[model samples]
Target: MEVFVARSHPVDTHVGNRLRQRRALLGMSQTDLGNAVGLTFQQVQKYERGFNRISSSRLFEFSKVLDVPVEHFFDGMGATAVAAKRKPGRPRAPEKPADSDLNTKRETLELVRAYYKIRSKSLREKTRDLIIALARD
Candidate 1:
């Protein structure tokens, strides 16, 4: 079956390219990644080709499965490191957060699973409010 082409952002293209590059860097074949993700090789091909949309759940799964940070897939876009560092209205030098404390795929995947278990919408909202409040201070 032929995959359909839809309108895409430059960032989408960048993300797909990054996925393919990282797979190649790890010496993983499309079939291999497909097996890891319980997909057919053709499906993996479609994703890498940017003909299919990868859902956020799949993206999170991929990050853990690949043992990379979620941002690693979008690490170097048109935005430079310095650009990513600067948020509006923040005059101080951007403090870089350390990379993942959990190194292995197992650890990363476990953390992701736990994160999805939070049950309270109010808790999520409060957490978000607190984070934004803290960041602004």
Candidate 2:
């Protein structure tokens, strides 16, 4: 007899990362997202952490609320992440070193929001150029 142990799929993690990125970029809180989808914030957290697999209908609802296409959640997912499905009673694939996803960071989101709030086109360009120059050092 085989037992099925639930594990987070790499695809799910990728989708969750995208979900978090989009939500944060739009300045939406987990509570805000939950209320829009009729779920609690904890449920939203679980979804964002890939602990809960979102249903297709729920995903559609999220897409609608987030003002994104349904395909957005799968953006940037590699073929290896898609192919590494977990089987019943099988150990999950070893996690690869993830590239630093700046979009998923709260600091990055805050910085982006603050940058847009500058409101002057030339000032924004100067700020961007300054940051790029600083990064090159």
Give TM per candidate: 0.51, 0.85
For model 1, how big is the CA root-mean-square deviation?
A: 14.6
Candidate 2 yields a Cα-based lDDT of: 0.86
Q: What clash pairs does model 2 have?
A: none
Across residues 66-122, which tens digit of lDDT does each residue of candidate 2 receive?
Answer: 999999999888888878867767776567533376667778888998999998999
Angstrom error of the Cα, residue 36, model 1: value is: 0.5
Model 1, span 49-77: residue lDDT tens: 65676887787777787789889877766
Lowest-sum lDDT 10-residue window in model 1: 95-104
Q: What lDDT score goes with residue 69 in model 2? A: 96
* CA RMSD of each candidate after superposition: 14.6, 2.5
Off by over 4 Å in 2: 1-5, 96-99
